[model samples]
Target: MATTPVTQGSTDRRRFRVTGGRQTSPQQPALSRWELQALLLILALAAVLYAWGIGHAGVHPYYGAVVRSMAANWHAFFFGGLDPSGWITLDKIPGALWPQALSVKLFGPYDWAAALPQALEGILAVWLLHRIVRAWAGPLAGLLAALVLTLTPITVALNRHTIPDTLLVLLLVLAAGSLQKAVGSGKLLPLLACGAWVGLAFQAKMLQAWLVLPVFAAVYQLAAPGSRLDRAWRLLAAGATALLVSCSWLLVVWATPPESRPYIDGTTNNNPFTLAFGYNGLSRFGDDPHALGAVAGTTASRTSGNTGWTMLVNDIVGPQISWLLPLTVLALVLGLLWRAGQPRTDGRRAGFLLWGGWLAVHVVVFSTSNGNHGYYTAVLAPALAALTGGGAALFWAEYRAGGKRRRALPAAIGLTALWAVVIDGPHGRFAPWLLPVVLMLGLCGTAGLWSSGPRTTPRALHSALAAGMASVLLAPAVWAASCLDSRYAGSPMSPLAGPVGPGYREMRHHGTKPRPHALNTPSVRDAALLNYLTAHRSGEKYLLATQAAYGAEPLLRATSQPVLVMGGFTGLTPYPAAHHLNTLVSAHELRYVLLTTRRPSTSAVFWVKQNCTRVPPRAYGRIADGSFTLYDCAPGV
Candidate 1:
C-alpha cells in the first residue's frame, strides 16, 4: 500500500493511509505480541488497583442506603429513592447508582458487590482509553495511556467506592471513544451514538457530563470528512438526541403524580427540571442562592477550601489528581504547536485537541466551582493519560529526527519529576525516601534523553524512556496504593486517598484502623434505639422519622424497614411538612420521631415535641447528654 509519512524519522517511520476518509496507520500492526502483553499487564494493574480488598471497603452511606433500597424495591429502583418505601428521592439523579444496585441484587448487597461495578467500569475505561490513543498514535502510546489512567490516585480511590463519579468517568470516556469513531468514519450513526453516550452520562451526573459537548463538537467539526455546513447540521441533530435522552427520566418523574412518587429532593417545587438545572447544575457555580449556600455550608465543602486557579494543586487535590498536570499541559501545548501546519482534519492533531480540551474544560470548571470534592477530579484522568501517552510518542519520534523538538521529551521528564517532588514535599513524613528515588530517576532519564541520538543503542534508548516514564508516574502509583490502607477506610463519602490529615498519620503510626464515618457505622446507642422502636412498632408504615438522611442512613443500611427522612439531605429540604407528619401520626402510620437536640428546631421537630411524648434515654438503655430526643408520636401518647 502507498502510505503517507506522518512522522519524519527514517529509523522509526510511521505512516498513515487515508481511505474513504478514514485514517489508518500502516506501520502499527494490530495487536502485536508485545502490545498484547503490555495491554494485559496494564489491565492487571488496574484490576489490582480498583478491586483489591474491596470486600472490606467502606460504602458511602447515603448512596449505599439507596442501592440497598433499589435492589429490593423496584419502586425505589426506578425513582432512585432514599428509602425502601420510596418516600424521598436522593439529591442527585439515580442512573450512576443503577449498576451498583443491580450488582447488589445479584450479589446480595455486600460492600464488594456495591463496589464491583465501578471497579469493572474503571477497568473498561482503561481499555477503552488504550484503544482510542493507540488508534491515533500507536500501541506504545496506547499502553502508556492505559497504565497512566490505571494508576491515577483519584481514579483508584473513586473506583473503590460506591459513588456516582466513577460511573460518570466511565461513561464520559466511552463517549470520547465514540466521538473518535465519528471523527474517523464521518458517519451520522457514530455521532448520534456519541450524543447518546453523553446523555447517558448526564444521568450519571446531571450537568457535569455535558462539559465535554463543546470539545466533541469542535473536534468533529474540525476533523470530520464533510462540508462545514453538513457537520454543523449533523451536530444539531446529535444535540437534539442528547437532550431527548437526558430528559428521559425527568419526563417520567414529571408524568408521575406527586402522590404516586417520592418527593424530589433539593428543589422547592418538586419539578425534576428545577432539580436538574437549578439545584445540581447552576447551583454548582453559585447561581442559585439557596442551593449554593447549602453546599457551601456543608462539612465537605468547608474542608475543600476556597476556589481559585491554584485549587487543583492545593493540599486537598494535588496528590489525588494533579500529579500529571504539568506534564499534560506541556504535552498539549507542544503537540499542537508542532502539528500547526497539518491539515485541519489531521488525526494526530485532533487527538491532541480532543484530550487537551477535555482536560482544560475540567480544570477551569473544577478550579472555579463553588465547592467540589477531591474525588470529583477523577474525570480528568483519561484526558491526562491520553495527552501524556500521545505527546510522549510525538516527542520521541521528533527527537529521533534530530529536530528542534528534541528537547521536548527531556523537558517533560524533568518538569514532571520536579512537580512530583514538590507535591511530595508536604507528605514527606509519610514517604521520605520516595522523593529521593523519584528525583534520581528523573535526573538520570533527562540526562540520558538529552545525550542519546540515532547512534545510541536500542536497549539504552528504551531503558532511558522507561526511566523517564517511571519518574513521571511513581508518586501517583504510591498515592493510589494508599487508598487500600486501613487508616483511610472512613472516607467513602469523600473518597480521598493519601495522607489526608494528622489522623491518618496517627493511625498509621499506631498500626490501627480509623473509626468509620458516623453515617456508615451506627453507634451502640443507635442499635438500642432500633431495638426499642422495633419492639414497640404497631403496623406503622414507617419504622420512625428522622430529621435528615444523615440520621436515617445507617438505619436504612441496617434494615429494609422504611425510615422517613423529614427534611431530605440537609435539614432544610422541607420535605415531610409538619402537616404531613400530623396526618401520619393521626392515622397511626408513623409512631416515632427522632430529633437532634440542637436549638431552633424545624417545624417537624416542633410538632413532634408539642404533641408527642419524649422517651427518656433510660428507656433505651443509655444515659443522655441531651444530644437527641426520641418522641413517641402515637396518638394520645
Candidate 2:
C-alpha cells in the first residue's frame, strides 16, 4: 500500500508561517499600509502623553536644591565659584553641575530649566525605542515596546522631575541604540557615537556607564559569533573614547589651584580626581569611619540607604502596584526565555540583554553594598518594558491559538485593569464590573490576533489589538495621572483626601505645611537664630560648626553669608579637607555654634544635633524653643 507522495509545495502551503518570517504568500502581505499607519499613530500618542505631564509633576526637594544651587552660582568659564567658606564637600562629579548650569543659562533661574532637558530626553528615548524595535521586531512589537515605555509610571515621574536618573537613562538608551546599530551594520561611526553616548551616561551618573557595556558586549558576541573579536575591539575603543570625553572636565579640575578646586572638590582637598574617583567610588563600596555623613558613610543609617533604593525603583518602574507585581515577575521570566530562544538577529535581542544585564548589575551591587533604593531600579525599566511587551505579544499569540488558552489573557488583563481601577482608580469607589469589561476586551483582542493569525482579518480587529496594547502600556500612566489630579488638582475624589494628604485640609488641620520640609526649617530654634545672625552680621563670612553643617548651606547661601558646616563627611567638597572637617571644625573661623538640646530621631537630623555641643555655652545666645541655643563664636565675645 504505497501512500501518495506529498509534494513539497503542497506541504509548505498548509504550514502556518509566523509573521515576518521567511515564508511568503500573496494572500498575507508583510504589513499592510494601514498597520504601519496604526503603529505610527500609536507612537505619536504615546509620545504626547509621556511629554505632556512632565511640567506639572511636583519637584523632588533634594534634586530641586541641587538645581537651584547650580543656577544661583553659574559663571561662564568656571562653574560655581569656590565654596565661600572652604566647607565644600560634594565636589565629586563636576559633570552633574554643568547641565543644570546650562539650563539656567538658557532658560533663566527656574526649576523648569533643570526639568525640561530630562523631559525632552525622555521623549527622545521613546522615539529611539520605537525606531530600534521597529527596525528589528514587527510593527506590533515596536508599538507595544514604545507604548510600554511611554506610560510606565516610573518613567513618567522621572521625566517630569529634575533628577540625574532620567538623564542617565536617556543616555544609556542612546548608547544602547548606537551600539545596536554599530553591531548590526558594522559601522565605525556608529561605534564612535556609541562611545560618545556612554561618556554622556558617565557624566550623568559616574561609573554607572559600565553597567550597560558588558551586557551589550555579551549579546553582541552571542549574536555574531564570527565577529566577536572585532566587536570586542570596537567596544573597547568606544569605551576609551567615552572615558576621554567624560574625563576632560575632571582633568582640568585636577590642574586648577586647590582654592579653585573648592568648587569641584568641595573641600580644600589634595586631588579632585583621586578624591572623586577614589573616595567617591571605592569608599562607597567599602566601609569608612571618616566617611560619616557622606552618602556612603558607615554612620549613615540603613533607613536612608533603603529609602534611596526605594525611591530609585519607584521613580523608574511603577510603584509595585500590588496587582501588577506578580505579573511583572512572570513577564520578566517569559521575556528572558523568549529572547534567549530568539537570540540576536538584528540587535533587538542584544538590546534586551544589555538592558536586563544593566538592571541586574545595579540591583546586585546596590542591594549588597549596604545601599539600595527603589529608584535605582529605574535603570532596568526599559528592559523590563521590553520583556513585558514580548510577554504580552506571546500571550496574545497563545490566546489566539486555543479557546482554553484565551481565558488566561483576559483573566490577566482583567485583574490588572481591575486592580488599577480599585487602588489607583479616579474615585475610592470600587468598580467590580470593570474587570469583566476588560476581560471582554481581552477576549476581543485574542480573537483579533487569532483570526488575524498567519492569515487575513478585518482592519478593525488589527486596530483594536493595537489599541489594547496601548491601553496596557498606558495603565500606569493613567493611574498616575489620576493620582496627580486627585492629589494636586483640588479634586475631592482623590484617594489622599484626609489630613495626611496635600491640600488645605492637610496644612490647616495637621500642622504639616504643603511645602516640602527641608532640614533647615526654623523648627529648630537654631535655624531662626542663624537667620537672626544673617540679619545682624549682614555680609561677614561665618563658619557654622556641627556634624551636619552642610544641611544649612542652602539657607546660608540664601543669605549671601558664607558658612562652613563642620563635623560631617565631605560631600560637594573633596576628600582630605572633607576628612579634616569630619574630624573637627576650626574654632577660629567658626564664629557661630548652633546647638540642639535634643538628639535627632533620624540619622541625618542626628548628625545636625551631634555637632551642636561643640560650641561653648558662654558664647551662646538665650535658648529659643527649649530645643536649641545659638552661640556667637566671635573672638572674646
Candidate 3:
C-alpha cells in the first residue's frame, strides 16, 4: 500500500503514487493560497502577543542582576554568578540565562534586552507548533493550534518576562515535533534529535523536562515502524543521549576547583547535584529542613491552592490555562475512538496519544506535587493547543462525512461553553460578558448543526463549525488579553494572568510598588546607606555583609560591586559559617554587616549583632524601623 510521506514542501507533494508496483513521490507544489494566508496570520498574531510593549514588561530582578553580572564578566557568565565579583553562583542552572546575558552584553543590559530573547523564542515556538501540526494533520489544524498557544494567557504572560519556562516550552515543542518526524520517517536520527531537544530543555528546567520521556517512548513504540525490541533499544539510546546532553554543563561545573569558581548557592557542600536533585528537585515535593521558607517557619503553601485532583480547576489556575481543557479532553477521547481501526502507524491516533499523554502526565505530577506555581502551567499550553486543534480537525472531518460523528462537533462546543461558564465562577469578575457570549455562540452553532440536514451547504457547515470553535476559544483569548493591561502585567518573580484569583490580586497590588534597586539605580534610602558604607569603607574585600540575596541583589543591581550574602537566596542555606564571618571581620576583610531584625536570626546574623558595633540609624539616614539593623565592624571598635 502506498503511504503519505512527510514532506517539507506543499501538502500536494505529500501524496505518493504507486507506479509499476513501486511508490513514487509527487512533484513539489507551492502552498495553497489559504495555507499561506493562515500561516502569515498565525505568525502575525504570535508576534503581536509576545512582542508588543515588551520593553515595559517587568523583569525578575534577581535574574536580571545575574544577567548583568554574567554580561560584565566571562567567569561569572560561565558559572551563573549572582554578583559581578563572582562571590556565589545562582541557585538554579544558568543555561536559560545565557541568551539573556548575551543579549544584555550586546544591548547594554536594558530590561527589554533581557526580555527580547524570551519574546523571540515564544514567537518561534508558535511558528514551530504550526509547522509540526500542519505536517501531521493539515494546515488548518496547525494554524488553530498555533492560535490557541499564542492566546494562552499564561504563555503570553511568561513570554513577556525573562523566565526559564519560555525556553523550556520552546524546546519541549521542538522535541515533540522531532518525535513526530521520527515516527513518520522511521529513522534513528530524528529519534535521537528528539532526545537532544529534551536534554536541552532539561537545562532550562531540571527534572520537569523529563516528564515527557515516557510519553515519547510510548508513542514511538506504538506508532513507529519497528519491532518492539528494536524500538525499546532505540529508546535506551535516546535516553542516554538525553542524560549526556543534560549533564554537559554540570560536568564542567563539577570539575572546576572549589577555589577557582563561585560557590554553588542553595547547597551546603557546594555540590551541583545536591542543588539540582535535592534542593530544586525532590525538596520541592516533600519537606526539607534546609528550605529557606521552611527554616524560617513560614506556613505558606507554595502552590496557588491546596494540592489535589481539583487543583487545576481551582479559581487560581483555571482562569489561566483550563479554559479549553474539557474540550481538548472530549476531542481526545472522540478522536481516539474514531481512529481505532486505523493501522498502528496512523498519524492522527498517534497525535492524540502523544499530546493526550503529555497533558495527562503533567496534570498528575502538578496535581500531587507541592511548590507548583500557576505559571508553571505554561508548559502544558503546547500540548493542550495541539490536542484541541487536532481534535477539532478530527471532529470536523468526521462531521463532513455525514455520520454519527456529526454530533461530536456540536457536543464539544456545548460542553466547552458550559465548562467556560464554570471556570468563570459565580462572580465572573474578570470578564462577565465573556461567558454569555460563549454560550450564545455555542447555542448558535449547536442549533445550526442540529437543524442543518443533508440540504445544508458546505459554506453553511463551515460557518457553523467556525462559530463552534470561536465559542470555545473566546474565554481564553479574552483572559490572555488581560495581560495587556498595565495593571495585569504580572510580577517579575511569579507571573499570573487574568484578574480572578488571589495570586492576581496580590501581584496587582505589588506590581506597582517601586523596587529599591531597579535597574542600575538604587532607592534614596538604599543610596544613602550605600554612601555611608562607601564612606566608611576600609580595604574590605566585600562592601558589606547581608542576610541573603534579598539584601545583596539591590546593592549588586545598584552598583556592580561585591556584596556578601551571609546565606543564599533564603538566608537558610549554610554558607560562610559564623566563625568564617568572624575571621573576615577580625581580619578586616569585611567591615560592615546588615542583618534582618526578624526574630530567630541565623547564627551569622546573631554573631554580627553581638560582636559588631550597632551603627546609629541617624548615621546611615535610616529611621530605625526595626526591620533591618546596620552594624559597623570597624577594627578598633
Candidate 4:
C-alpha cells in the first residue's frame, strides 16, 4: 500500500497513516511543557524557603565555633577540634564539619557563610529525589515526590541550619539514586559507586549511613544481570569499599602521635575508636530502656507526653512533619498489597521495598534510642515523599486499566485525603481560613474521582489527582514557608514552624538571658572576667581553665584566645587528669582555673582549689551564678 511518510521522533505517526491505512494518536512527552514549568516553580519555591533569612547567627553555637576554628588552621580542620587552640577535638567526625569550614574559609566566618553550603545541599537533595523517583516510577511521580520533599517543614528547618544532617541526607539520597541507576543499567560500576556514596555518607554521620545497605544490596542482587554468587561477591566488595572510605580518617587519627594531635573529646579515653563506636554509636541506645533524657523531645517540658511512638506523632514530629505521614504509611501498605509475590527482579516492587526499608529501619532505630532528637527524624522526609509519589503513581496506572483495582482507586483517594487532614489538622498551626479551604477542595477532589466515568477527559483526571495531593500537602507547605524565617538562635532544635511577626527577634548571644555558660559574645560580667584573664596572663598557653566547653566558648569566640575545657559536652567525662593539669601549669600552658558551681568532680578541680588561691568577687564583675569560683593557678602563686 502507498503510504505517507511519518514525521521524525513520532513512532505513532509511522505506525499509522491515511494512505490506505488507519491513523494513530500522539503520545505525550515524558515531561510535558506545562509539567516542566511546574517543576521549575517547585524548585524556585524550595530555594526561597531554604535560603530566606539564613544569615542569622547559628542555632548551635558549638558547631559554628568549630567551623570558625576549622577555618583557622590545618590541624583543627583535619581533626575537627573544638577550637583553634588544637588542644582538644570536637565530639564528632571531621567530615561533617568540612563543608561548613570550607564555606567559612572562602567567604569569611559568619553564620550565613557556615550555613550556605547546607542550604545549597538541601536544594540539590530535592532535585535528586525527583530524578530518582522519576527513574523508577515516571516523571509525574518524580515531580510529585520532589514537591513533597520541599514542603516538609523539618526538612526545611534542618536544611536552613549548619547541621551536618543536611549533608548526611544528601549523600544518602545520592547513594539511593546510584543504586536505582545501577538497577536500570545492570552495570557493576554504578553498583560500586553506590557503596562509595554510602561510605561518604558515613563520613557525614558515622553508623547511620549503613542502615540502607541491606535494601541497596538486595535490590542490586535481584535486579542486576549477573549470577547470584557473583552478585554476592560484588556486594561484599562494595561493603569493603564503604568500610575503607569510612575508616580512612579514623586510621589517620589513630596513626598520629598523641602529643601532636588533639585529644578526641567525646570518649572516656581520648581515642577515635571509642569516640566512633562508643559515644556517637552504641551508647546512643541506652541499655536501660528508660534512661533519663534517653529519648529527646519528650524530656523537654513542652513535649511532656511525647514518648514512644507518639514521639513522631504530636508534639515532636506531628506538627513539624507527619502531615503526609499517614499517607506515607498507606502508600507502603498499598505498595505491598499491589505487588505481592511479584518477580524478584520487579523494579517497581524494588522501589517500594527500598522506601519501606528506610522508614522501617529509621523508625525502629530512632524509637528505641534515648539519644534521638526530633531533628534526627528529619532524614525520613525524602523517603516518605518518594514512597508517596511512587506508590500513588503505581496505583493510578493500575486503576486506569479497568479492573478490580480501578473500582477501589476512588475510595483510596477519598480515604487518604480525609486521613491527611484529620491526622494532624487539629494540632497544626495554620491560617484560620486555610484549613476550611483544604477540606472543601479535598472533598471536591474525592467527589470528582468517584464521579469520573470512562468518558472523563485526561485533563479532568489530572486536576482531580492534583487536588488530592495538594490536600495532603497544604499544611506542610504553610509550615515550610514559616521555616524560612524561623530564628532558632543558639540551638535551633525546635521543629515547630510558624510565621514570625515583627515582635519575633533572633536570639542574640549575650549574657542577658540565662545562658548555659557564657554566650558566644561577652556581657559586662563576661568582659570583666576576660579583662582579668587578659591582664593576668603570665606567659601561659591557655588564658583560663573552665569546667566544660560551655564556659570556654564565649572566651574563645570573643577574644580568639586559648581557653581549656576540662571535659566535653556533658562536663562529667574525665579527660585531663590531675597530673596533666599540673604538667600544663608547670609548663606554663594553663594559668587561671575557672570552675562552675555544681560542676562534675575531677581531681584537677581539687588540685586547683588546694594549690591555687581563689580570686575575690570584687576583682571580677557581678557574676550570674556566684557559685562559679575563679582560682589563681599561676605557678608559685
Judging by lDDT against the true structure, name the best candidate.
Answer: 1
For model 3, residues 547-636, the per-residue Cα lDDT tens digits are: 877677767766767778777776766777899898988787899888874434678887887888988998988887467888888766
CA lDDT, every model vs. true structure:
0.81, 0.50, 0.78, 0.70
- Which has the higher lDDT value, candidate number 3 or candidate number 4? 3
Residue 70, model 2, lDDT: 51
Residue-level lDDT tens digits of model 1 in 44-103: 989998899988666887888888888879999999998989998888889998998899
The superposed Cα distance between candidate 3 and the true structure at residue 359, in angstroms, equals 0.3
The regions of model 3 sitting more than 4 angstroms off are 1-30, 287-306, 501-503, 506-517, 586-588, 598-600
Question: CA RMSD for every model?
Answer: 3.0, 8.8, 3.8, 7.0
Q: What TM-score goes with each of the models?
A: 0.94, 0.68, 0.91, 0.86
Candidate achieving higher TM-score, 3 or 4: 3
Ranking by lDDT: 1, 3, 4, 2
What does the lDDT read for residue 107 in candidate 1? 82
**After aligning candidate 1 to the native by TM-score, how far in Å is the CA of 468 from where it should be?**
1.6
Q: Candidate 3: how many backbone clashes? A: 0
Put the candidates in TM-score order, highest first.
1, 3, 4, 2
Candidate number with greatest TM-score: 1
Question: Candidate 2, 563: how far from true, in Å?
Answer: 3.7
lDDT of 3: 0.78
